[model samples]
Target: MQVKTDFNEKQIQILLIAEKLFAENGFEGTSIRTIAKEADINIAMVSYYFGSKEKLLEALIVYRTSDLKIQMENLSVENLDPIEKIDKLIELYINRIRCNKGIYRILHFEFSSEEMEEKMKILNDVRDRNLKSIETIIHEGQAKGIFRKDVNIPLISPTIMGTFFHFSMNKAYFKKLLKLDTDEAFENYIQTTFKTHIQQTIKALLIYES
Candidate 1:
């Protein structure tokens, strides 16, 4: 599905509010009225902007994921080595999810609902495109003899995403375990320590061991 790229400030505000509601309440549980009320607008304005809850969900997904697609496209054209490309990809994915935790949370919650089959298709399509981009980078590495020939391309994305998702979902527990008292400190750990660990994990999976 083609996503609308241009949005006004009011439209973006509505989308952000909807994303937060959807993450906390799930798509089926969130109503247009609720979103409108949260955004301090009338239901008619919500209807005018998105027409319906389903379309709003689609717009939210598109708004959240389109930039990542663009970033991946840009990364594909860079002159970096395959290993460097993978590292950059890891950084991009982590940073994107960190910044947009609400939308990602919505995705995780609504992805398996039987009522959201159509919306899940949109999400799956975006995921497939990203996985294909990662696969391309791995193929480049293998072709250059920089990575192992026996790599399982399909598992790579899940490995990176799943690890982060597990950590993020249980962050409160981990925060106390690690003695991270402030949000800034936890974010610092993610960008530095957690990010480096993921990069190294992917490197170990892809790189050739002589």
Candidate 2:
């Protein structure tokens, strides 16, 4: 089943609460009752909205990631050059992950569990769609003779995502090492220093050397 696009106020509220709880306590640890209580709704309401915890988790993934498709579609049609499109893609990815770290963490957890193959299918499908979008950008650059011909297009996403994931996973250590005093300071570093670094790295990969 696809993720529902239109969520009412209450459904969105429940989804947000479920996302937070799943990220904090995990699917096994977070019960329907806990979600209901956290959302200040009854368990029946939770059941009515999502039949089970698994369904809720699936819905959460859909709710969180469904917008990426639309965003990517919009970016593809923009009047920007391929390089500028790539830069915008980086910015979009970074901002999206920064805002929804919790849901991503849950996705990571679900990905590693064999019992969650159905959920994994949903996540993998979304990933493939996103990768195709990224590939389109790279192909556009290649067609224009801007990007190198021998580029390993598949590795590009991991390079961008892996670097950010590594930093975020160890953000506390990095923050202390960088002498950042507050969350705002660290985030500023990410949006500026880290983002530019990703853009530079990708440009280096895609650009041909004379």
Candidate 3:
């Protein structure tokens, strides 16, 4: 599927409702009628726009990731230093997790389902491209002698992805433990502490002395 230029109001509304429903209920558990009622649209409209429940889910994934190619291009922008590029990436990952919060859950849900294999292919390709973008930053740093030559991209990449995912996915536990009951308090923690931590960890790994 093509990366959309942008979605119109109705398309966005349906996708958002689907995202929330899929987050609360598993994909198979949610129904088109439920989405239509919640979204206040006709069932035929949903089918007309997305063709099937599977395509609607695919569209949801695409809507979220439509800017990936642009982000991929950002990795090569000469205006940003290698470290700045890494910061951009860290910011991207953390903020996306922070804002949507449901994206990774839906992604993981697909991974654990046999019915989701075809859908997984599209996401997997996007992931491989993003990984290559990170490797390009490392290569740039190494070229400039700023980053260590022995640094491992594959293993270290997980440090960024895993930590960001873990914190967001487990935020309810964190909120209870930290006693951040309000939305403002929890978001402040993510926008401030959680973001800084990812940036610091990635930088430390990049510049670690051999």
**Candidate number achieving the greatest lDDT relative to the actual structure:** 1
State model 3's lDDT. 0.80
Candidate 1 TM-score, C-alpha based:
0.92
Worst lDDT 10-window in candidate 1: 113-122
The digit string of per-residue lDDT tens for model 2 on 100-176 reads 99998777664676767654567777888888888888888999999998989888878887898899889899999
TM-score for each model? 0.92, 0.92, 0.85
In TM-score terms, candidate 3 sits at: 0.85
Order of all candidates by lDDT, from best down to worst? 1, 2, 3
Higher-TM-score candidate among 1 and 3? 1
lDDT of model number 2: 0.86
Over the stretch 69-188, how does candidate 1's per-residue lDDT look in tens digits? 989988976899999999999999999989999998887666776657664567778888898898888888988999999998888888987899998888899899999998898899
Every candidate's lDDT: 0.88, 0.86, 0.80
Model 3, stretches more than 4 Å misplaced?
1-6, 155-157, 179-181
Clashing pairs in 2: none
Q: In order, what is each prediction's RMSD in angstroms?
A: 1.7, 1.6, 2.5
lDDT of 2 at 141: 90
RMSD of 3: 2.5
